[model samples]
Target: MSDGIDDAKRALRAELRERRQLLSDQARTTAEEGVHRQLDALLARTDVRSISCFLSTPTEPGTRSFVNAAIERGIRVLLPVTRIDGLLDWTVATPDGDVTDGLFGLPEPVGELLGPIAVNDVDLLVIPAAAVDHRGMRLGWGRGYFDKTLGSMERCPPVYAVIYDSELIDEVPRDVHDQPVSGVVTPTQTIVLSPQRH
Candidate 1:
């Protein structure tokens, strides 16, 4: 990653984080519901029996409702648990599962700790992103956790980033280690982008 592109990504992530923080309560509610619908729509198109997803922070597009609903539907949902080794552990999401702040203060489920490779069996992946460009490039929050997970997968499933409608932009700065998603699920719609090859 060039210093120029890295700097651009840092600035863009900050702006996107600020935008999320500024959302009104009503707007957040609506966006949360919209996210639920879009996620359901994504599931309708894919034949996933199990999936991997992140638990969103309050400011991010909400996924908690959908997680509960999926659990009710008997789908195995793996929630990411951050490990200190720069890899993610996993836990099965239960209805009303206990959540504690993991590394970087991200919400993580508390349960049986599955090893890092547990994600490999998931039929789909719904991850978080600061922004996703039209061509599927994902700009994360600089931790590189999701990027590394995707990169290490032997046969990655259809990965999608959850973002607000406006965060879907024309382009985003990228580096060699950045992993492209197969699509994006926004409050308004689900867009399939051509995933880039490393």
Candidate 2:
């Protein structure tokens, strides 16, 4: 039933995408502000000096605001730059850092290109997700970038997936290659999940 699972994931992702796109500007702004506050609080509770975060797309849960805030707070925030080889290169986020469209049209921060291994040194990893299950399985946007990164890390730190509050559901379609997150940061709350990773 792998095909069944894949089909379900695709269908769910499409619906989630449409739902996010339909959000009003005001509603989106409020959600973004909530996300920023939650992320700030997560940092306050942890010793996350260096972090790896994604530059959010328009319809995604806004991490750009949190990235900027982290920079202002003097926390080292690394943003992912997509690589054609299915690995990720990273760059340090700067105040007002310019971003350009990279592979898959994802907005990647423009700065000194650090290699894929750079993420290994981070205290925490804040990644993008379409949705995360209560058990912490992350349904990404049809890309295995984060899964590959997480699976390869030697001493992986706490990895958190950022999603909207409504996206936290009881269950999501999962596959053998799927990776489970340590927690999820939503617009409303930061829910720590327990799932043993392979």
Candidate 3:
């Protein structure tokens, strides 16, 4: 069963990755703007004071604007620093801050490492995903970094996955360790799953 799930996930990831790569530059920009708008509205509606979010890579739905805007609003932002042991460390993100090369070509903050459990301090958590299902299951990049982090948390805040609208599906293949998120933030809407079935 695990093998079947893994194969299915790989197939879905390839399909989504291809679709993302094929997006036209103008379309990608428009989609990114929509994402920013939705997230901005989310900020307005909630009293969340702190969040842990990812610094998006080029092919992913852009989070740079959202991260910057969050910082501008005086919201504390924590970015992940991938470690050698398949766990992640946390670091504060600043608008003018630069990132250093880290694992998997991720650009990590060049500040103090707040250890692995720093995520417990956030009011909310934002994560990156290749695809998400309607049930709020997120398909990550097969590294399991976020999965490990999510699984270890004793009491977690609302966790959201950032993805393009089309990436949300009816279902995604699941492994035993797969963690479901509380909500999803797409370019067009923010869907919070009720009766979260994690």
TM-score, predicted candidate 2 vs. hidden true structure: 0.97
lDDT tens digits, residue span 74-182, model 3: 9999999999999999999999678878987776788889999999999889899998887878899899999899989999888888899898898988988888898
- What stretches of model 2 exceed 4 Å from their correct place? none
Tens-place lDDT per residue, model 1, 1-198, is 899999999899999989999999999899989999999888878978999998999999999999999999889999999988999899999998999989888789999998999999999999999999988999999989999999999999999999999999999999999999999999999999997778
Residue pairs of candidate 3 with colliding backbone atoms: none
TM-score of 3: 0.95
Scored by TM-score, the top model is 1
RMSD of each: 0.7, 1.0, 1.4
lDDT of 2 at 163: 93
Regions of candidate 3 where Cα sits further than 4 Å from its true position: 195-198
lDDT by residue (tens digit), candidate 2, 1-198: 388999999999999999999998988888889999999999999967999999988888888888988999999999999888999999999987999999888788899998999999999999999999989999998879999999889999999999998999989899988899999998899999997675
* All candidates: TM-score: 0.98, 0.97, 0.95
Considering lDDT, where higher is better, how would the candidates rank from best to worst?
A: 1, 2, 3
Q: Give the CA lDDT, 0 to 100, for residue 184 in model 3.
A: 85
